[model samples]
Target: MTVSIWQADGTQPVREVDFLVVGAGIAGCASALFASQAGRDVVVTDARDIALGASGRNAGFMITGLADYYHKGIEQFGHAAARELWALSIKTHDYWRAWAREAGGVHMDQRGSMLLAESLEEAKELELAARALNADGIEAIYHAADPLKRGYFAAVEQPWDGSVQPVELAQAVLRLSGAEFIANNEAYKVEQISAELVAVHTRKVIFHARYVMLCTNAYSFTLHPYFRGMVIPQRAQVMVTEPLPDSVIPVCGYSDYGYMYYRMTHDNRLLIGGGRHKFFEQEADTTDDRVTDGVQGYLDGYMRRFFPEVNARVDRRWAGTMGFSADGVPLVGTLPDSPRIGFAVGFTGHGLAFAAGTAERAVDHLLYGTHPGALWAGRLTR
Candidate 1:
């Protein structure tokens, strides 16, 4: 199963490694980093060029907590579990920051997330949600009117959430760890070659290893068919405005529970994302990166509606696909019967903050047979 990827140049043979990881996104890189840290010979490869998937195309919003809001998380997963998840999210953010520092630091933007309500009723709901979260020891502030703006938009602020350059962060992790990265390589199927080893067959080469980790989010089905309905791939589009005027848009802001989001980068560029839900059926498919004019129109309309003063024009527009699970929480840890295989996917659009930590903890469990205690402990297949 040799596949060709653009910009991928290299020739290698069927080789053996202590650990083999698929997908070059953050999860795969983090897994390789952990395995190498354990003094294990590791090989990490991906179908496309490194960081060319959701990891590279993501909005890079470094949010705190799970995919669900902190307040909603408590109701969905209970107070104790939600708090535990929040703690782990903070820890993961710290881990990424440390990794960035070691690798010359990431494009770090400490700007917080602003949640704007589209209507007054939604504003009240947001206020209640913020109060609930604060009562549960989380930091969230509610505003009756968007203080950052002049008009009637109500909003809430989460001081902990921030943003980063997705591709730069992944590249930094790979460089700092010095892991063997085989880009433009595709692993179609993984077969268990032995009790403690698996074989990953690509088009040009075969990689045999003691363990194989699937970190390819939406494309997980290509390797593990069982993940079909369990992990759905949804397409998302993002557009970046050419550097804007100094004081045009705020650093970060989102509307409708993060469905439509826009932020002004440090360089004064407006980065906006989210329009998949508009074309739900088309967006949910596993294949397809084509951007529809309808979706783009909606995004443009959203920009105009929010930033009426600034006539921002998009300098770059791209599409990314993310994994969404049934429960909204990430599927971390190992598979039920296959201890030699571990994965951390189904991030549900919450990959940036937790993917690194999930991979580290997953590899620890795989190599050491010890389990971690957090919201992700028993949430996976195991």
Candidate 2:
């Protein structure tokens, strides 16, 4: 599986490996971990340092469901399909828990999570969702009473869901992966040279591998046209307030149907993220990672409205790009025309919940010819 790649100086530098994984995020790191564990020669390269992308800049929620609520998923994807999605979501959560435990268990907290409904209508929606979840043998209890005393009409608590320090988790996973990591090296292009070899061009050098896995997520579109329109890039803003006196947020939680999420860190900082719905048009199809005034303002207003008693100022703010498929499901397995190249992208805004799982599955498909079934990368129509 040796391939020759012409260097910028017109000389060919050939290096052969079993797997060359793009992006050092969670998915990339997980792929490297799985492949290396299976006795494969793996090298993972990233444009920036590990976990610098969305992998680090997320709300740190490790929930056990899709991006949408159970009821909403049923309405949009039908009952049977939605049930399967839920089952997979639970499996992803379990996988994450086990991995975190194996990585020393310091980066995760099993404090559980809740979905708060701010209005009576939203409360009904939570109730319906809880019913649907319980019917599928998952534990979901709906509470009409607001325990946080924030004037929420209702809430649903999933005892199994928890939170993880995303950055720490990613770093730990990278260390445990046992794969050669090349940081600050961005993969610019991937060319299939033969049936079993591919050339990956980066700024520093060209990597030749038997199998090339694309774990770049939102940035996948920049490397190839196959993902240009299929994987739409979206920018999400997030902020962390100064340390509060007590745990303002007792547990990880989401409101407004998982759009706005907040969690209390181990140091008692209120980490909140999500305003994409407020700036839907502005946030869509953009690779810009700059945090805008509009989205930040909305987040601040939301904090004030929800937690008026605590007036903690925002200490830090940033943005991260996420890839959203047309139907919001992640894409996994091999690409359309390039059989030697595989991809795991388009996780929407729920990368933490699905990235590692899908990356492992992609590696399985690439190495053993196993199909990803419903999550097949080529199944995305738009």
Candidate 3:
């Protein structure tokens, strides 16, 4: 995102904005909505159009919490933090569901979701996770044996989790936010000039904004050096089978220790994604959204292994880049040096689970100096 020495040469127009949001993805749009609700005139700008990044390319499973099993999350991040994060995820889902009801046409199916186990050890983990969830008063069904009879060992089902048309939902959020959107606008530099104004230098214009929120996620490294090691971009590959006569699976299924996921689309197509873990070096730390044969081959094997009955042809193959935090959680905070430049990034492939609540907390933090609780970026330093 470098500007050439000769291109435009200080000719870019300077626009004064109230609350300028960089990145029009789901997080950015949600931030805009909350900012607008706070009576700030918000403008959202993106490197690409709205929802064209991982927000659009994801499998659209609305499963809650971090991308780890509940028990594992508690073990990794302690019990209190895990419960807070799970509650935040539910809050995010509540916002999306309310917005969907308001939009009137957004496609959202509350068919619930399942965390199936591909191995015996994972099945044991699933049992623990289900027990932990139940002990915490979270309603979840634990299956000791394969519930789908698809050769899986066990499952943890969340009856409140669901699936969605991600792009449509993002667009609906943008429309509801009523923020002015600028597409194909790449913000190269953001600096707090003086103590009151933040300057955002983009390809189209220079915005002197009162506040700025970077929802860039996977692209966060491109804008600031602080995110270079904090947010690693990993590529995600996906392929959807041609429509079948009927639904193959009634719920969104995540298995193989969260490395692979499959769901039945509204049109009756089987969509499967993941396998980058099989080729870590090739898949990690890059923003290249290109499907690789290595990962796609793994997905092919996965489909055949779990869904041997499907004989449909592959309809399309695509890729996306997910931002993985160094700590396996979303980050929400302002730059310490430039506190006016706030951010909500590093969803770790759980944007739907974390983004809405994170964005709300981010906007409130940036606007009112409130703290972002468990998701505080300062935790990475501590």
Candidate 1 C-alpha error for residue 143, in Å: 1.4
State TM-scores per candidate.
0.92, 0.94, 0.98
User: lDDT per prediction?
Assistant: 0.77, 0.82, 0.92
RMSD of each: 3.2, 3.1, 1.0
- In terms of lDDT, which candidate is strongest? 3
Q: In angstroms, how far off is 81's CA in candidate 2?
A: 3.1
Task: For candidate 2, give the lDDT of residue 50.
Answer: 93
Q: Which lDDT tens digits does candidate 2 get at residues 236-297?
A: 99899999999887788888888888888877888888988988999988888999999999
lDDT of 2 at 180: 87
| lDDT value, candidate 3, whole model | 0.92
Candidate 3 residue lDDT tens string, 258-357: 8999999888899999998889999988888889999999999999988999998999999998999999899999987888999999999999998999
Q: Candidate 2 lDDT (Cα, whole model)? A: 0.82
- Rank candidates by lDDT, best first: 3, 2, 1
Better by TM-score, candidate 3 or 2: 3
Error of 1 at 153 (Å): 4.1
RMSD of 2: 3.1
Q: Kindly report which residue stretches of model 2 are placed more than 4 angstroms away from their true locations once superposed.
A: 1-12
Q: Per-residue CA lDDT of candidate 1, range 113-189, in tens?
A: 88888778778778877888888767788888887774536887888778888888899887766778887778876
